[model samples]
Target: MSFVRMGIVGIGNMGSAHAKYLIQNEVPEAQLTAVCDTNPEKREWIRSQSGDSVQFFDTPESLFESGSVDAVMIATPHYSHSELAIKAFRRGLHVLVEKPAGVYTKQVREMNEVAAQSGKVFGIMFNQRTNPLYQKLRDLISSGELGDLKRTIWIITNWYRPQSYYNSGGWRATWAGEGGGVLANQDPHQLDLWQWTTNMLPKRLRAFCGFGKYHDIEVEDDVTAYVEYENGATGLFVTSTGEAPGTNRFEISGDRGKVVIEDGKLTFWRLRISERQFNKEYNGGFGQPECWKCDVPVRGVETGHKGITENWVSAILHGTPLLAPGEEGIRGLQLSNAMHLSAWLDNWVEIPLDEELYLEKLNEKIEASTFVKKSQCAKILDVRGTF
Candidate 1:
């Protein structure tokens, strides 16, 4: 039960949360060796909390070169994820990265290459995958109880961000900073969940995205993506930062029935089969032929970010399988980028999206744009469940 030496880069909102989870819990498996952030104040704040007298570095490379850490958790901006992950991996350190592993599919592929070469575990911080409700849904789908998942619609609009929420951080909502909105920040969880539960990637996508429709942000604050999966299944993914009192409702309809996750509960509606043998042969069918809403209770720890972090640390330190791997991250990022590209170009973008083209378009904007002034941003109105 030796503790794994750990270092964290970027002490922002998410980074700080990972640090807190590591130090304030029964993490007999990890020790915070150092913390790194360019901001002096953020570094100082982490020092005060952990009281590790741990060393702090000004740059990610410095943290890697210091030889003071065995593993590193990267909580930097979306654009920086690939660079930091590659650097840490090359240095022979295990890495954990925040959601949307890279801003684009190409960048993620490059990161995957580095991890493969390094032969180190690369974990993505898609914490929402650890939710029992999602876990059960994934299990049910994989178990084939649903009889071929046909369609999934995830209406997750409840990620409420106030104007000050975006204003509180300097590197938020800007293309040069976060790469995109809602999809990149608030909806990464839902996006990842969409792929994880269905276990299918869309073959093509058409999206309608509203940039600055509700907020004064430069990227999409609202998005609706129409997806056609390889198996001919369709999906509708919609989300927005403008909506308040929003609801998170996920429904998957298969040939047999439907699985709905809402209000923190999972309900399975089983379609009564005409073949009594099929019902009798199945483990969960109870030898009955009928359609009933089966309540699937959430199991395990309370659904929260901390639980995911604990599993992340444990999975790496011990031999526990990661809830979300870095490679799986690429699918979610591709989905997000596809939607953005489709909306931006006003055309259907194919899956395994044209990474080079997307990068080119993004670079053009990056080179031509000027940073938006926070003072110029319009006040975001608080609306309820309107995605």
Candidate 2:
């Protein structure tokens, strides 16, 4: 097996988590070669945690300039994701970017273009896509076992956060730092899951948002979006950071079955649909298809973040096919952007959304922003709910 040297930019929560996993698990084909962070305190802490033997730098450029790493994992704040990933790619390094690939669709597209030009593996940290229940649900939909999907409703309100959580960082809820609220941070995984399982793109989006309903922030704390796809299939996405005792329930209905991904489990109901109804040509009930539901156990074993991360390293070193391609990330980001645009303008927006328009709207919010955010949580509310 070929061994790949690894470097990490931004030694924050996710970065630190990745560092720990790399060092402790001893990924068979990967090695932790360097770590980077802007904060002196964080730099010192990483040195203490990893000892003097490993290299540490204060800027991503320094790490990339060293040319000692084969790949770099970016766990920085949202704004820097695109720039850093592009930089790493330009230096002939494979990259694994943390979720919400970038703060906006345009930035994510630029990173994707750079990755394509560089001819190196570019991966997104959509770890939830690796979860067993979600995998099973995706498989069912792809296999035709679920038949033609009609509607999907994801009531994922369980992403509860308190006021102090937002206060933990100045950047947490600010438009300038993070972009949006629930959609950017807590719900990127869910948004990506929406696209992955549906296997379709939206035709239009309409939404209503509650801006800072429970938190003192500029962006939304809760949001509800109604999406229509090209085939006339519809979807409902509901997310909130203020709701307590929340539940994450995803219900996807098709002509043959309905699949629910919730509480780390997959439940599916297989239905018998009537070809007979079509053949009968009834005068009164001409279009209605008769159906009966039967419970079907989701087929697939479980795998989570560790599985995806390990596979990512393996894919880089051994050419394994990716679970989630980096380019597909833009789809979810576009969906989020369209929803926010719809809610902000109080109108429905069509899909294949205009990236320039979204960026213009984002810039407007950035110019208008007044809130002082200091940490990750603050930035979270600002951009997360926007989408």
Candidate 3:
């Protein structure tokens, strides 16, 4: 196959954007061939945009069986990602799922298992991975430019959303609908980048979450999590949709030096020698490691969702490597789930999280909940700047 015929399920905000670019041939080797949505208005809107060249289906199952597409992009709610991807993979099609792979890891694990057995290209829409700044950081850390990891701290709270933003969609912040707030919806990119750039997941985590603290919904709008990695490296992650004049700064301290990314720039502080080495050999009682501040150049602009879609198509057609393998999506979701679970239990949660326990707690939240959404109608707000 020289190109991929991509079908999109859930032609809502993100899904509609994918369709527009694909229809415009933004991806050289891909085309928008089919779409599925329960909303007749969305279907008609997409049909007007693409004409008869594209097929439309009211249900995902019909779309999967229509044979109009060689691959599928699942952009539905957080809870349906895994189920839809599993269905698409079973139908012998490549699958690309949106972030926060699923609400929990257990279902995502099952979806991943099926994708592995299907021998199909599976990708995720972790478009932030395409950012040159973050890419450079991951390269430096993995290439040992930052030496051994020591501590990592990220305060990425610039994801401020107003009450109307939550009101834009009925499923926006409701626990029974979208799963979790800030962490699940807004900060998946940062959480994924944190572990991906450092190449480590937490050994254990203790998270403090404020449910509905700033929003009129049931899920967390504020969070502070502290974690310890397997290498004895500790880390802190803080995020919220509640604060104004929010800050986004990611800092990493290594045995050799430190690196910081903030305000669209990355700064590196290089030490003459490892801090441990300097501390061990130095005779001065109050000496510090010699450090040099250098502004690192990050080449290329982030291609956003287009980059990921192109990569997924390339992986399907030309055997190219996927920038965001769908299997890895579970990692970020793990961090999100652990944070929520820790808050639910009011205690620490260990890594390799107890999935059964998490599910039980989640069910309790669903069953004992009295929170209600402001709107029950589905609305597709402009997702242009949201991500």
Candidate 4:
């Protein structure tokens, strides 16, 4: 194929953002051939954006089988992601989905298998993976410059969203519609980045969550989770959508030193020697390892969504490796689930999550929800710098 015929399933905020850039020919080996959205308002919007060149399908079934595109990008709600991806895979098309792969891992696991069997390019929109700050962090960890991980703490309360943002649509923040709150909607990137950089998953976790703590929503808006890794490294994750004048800071401490990412800068505290070795060799009673604070230079601007879309096209046409493979999405979602499950059960949740139990508890929350969803209207927001 000269270029991958790209189709998008949801033309809401994120979807429309991708659609606009694609229509503008921002991605090198991709073209906007078609778009599918159940909302008629979205259809009208897509037409105005793509003119007569792009075909609009009201249903995924039509778009997948219509022969209008060679690949599909799914930007639907949290629950429908895996189901639609599986369908697109069965239709013999490449699939690129938005974050949090699915509400639960069991369903996402099935989708991964189908994608592997299809042998099609399956990717998730982990745009934060393209950030230079995080990319450098992963390099430092993988290259052993940071030695073994000791602890990680990220207070990412900058996901600040007013109640109006949640009230923009009925399906938002409701357990039945959007699954969870900040973790599902706002902080998937941070959740994904935490492990993507460290290459470690929590062995067990204890979390405290406040559902509708700062908003009139049925899902969590504030959360504080404590997690432990297999290697004995512990982490603290704190996030909220209600906190104003919020702070965004991530610190990764390792045997060699630690790196701090805040205010769009990476500060590396390098020890002259590994802490493990220092403990063995230091003769001074209380002297610590000599350290130097270096401003680790992170070059290049983060490509974000447009970059991921371009990478997906490159993978489709030339066998280039995807920056954010779809399978890796499950790991991040697993962390999110662990935290939620811990809070729900009011106990520590272990790894290898009990998928059945998670789903059961999730359903209980949904069944218990008395707040009625208002409307699934396409009230698209101007999501310029959301990620």
Give per-residue CA lDDT, model 2, range 1-387, as digits (tens).
Answer: 378889999888888988887777557678888999878887677777777756989778899989789999888888778888888998898998888888888778878888999999888888777766777778888888887788999998998999898888766777776778998888888899888977888899899988788799888889999999887789899999988899899999887767777676677665555343444655674455555554446555545555667778889878999887787788888888888888878999998877778877887787677643344334433432221
lDDT of 1 by residue, 1-387 (tens): 366788889888788887876777556577888989989898668768877567889988899999998888888877778878998999999898888787788878888988889988788888777777888889989988888768999998988788888787665787756778899888887888898887888999899999889877788899999899777789999899889888789999987888898887899898877333465577883455568888977778653666655666677767788777877888888899999899889999998888878877776554433453344321111011000
Question: How far is 274's C-alpha from truth in model 2 (Å)?
Answer: 4.2
Candidate 1 clashing pairs, residues 3+ apart or interchain: none
Worst-scoring 10-residue span by lDDT in model 2 = 378-387
Give lDDT tens digits, candidate 3, residues 91-124.
Answer: 9999999887888888889888999999999999
Instruction: Report the error of model 1 at residue 10, Å.
Output: 0.6
TM-score of each model, paired residue for residue:
0.88, 0.90, 0.95, 0.95
Cα lDDT, all candidates: 0.80, 0.80, 0.88, 0.89
The digit string of per-residue lDDT tens for model 4 on 1-387 reads 999999999988899999999999998688999999989888788878878899999899899999999999999887788888999999999999998798888888988999999999999999999999999999999999999999999999988898899888777788777779999888889999999999999999999999999999999999999999999999999999999889999999999999999999999999999999999988887799999999998998999999998998999999999999999999989988988999999999999789889878876776655533334312211011010
Per-residue error for 31 in candidate 4, Å, reads 1.0
**Can you give the lDDT of residue 27 in candidate 1?**
64
Q: Which stretches of candidate 3 lie over 4 Å from their true place?
A: 370-387
* Cα lDDT for residue 108, candidate 3: 84
RMSD list, candidates in order: 7.0, 4.0, 4.6, 4.7
Cα displacement (Å) at residue 344, model 3: 1.1
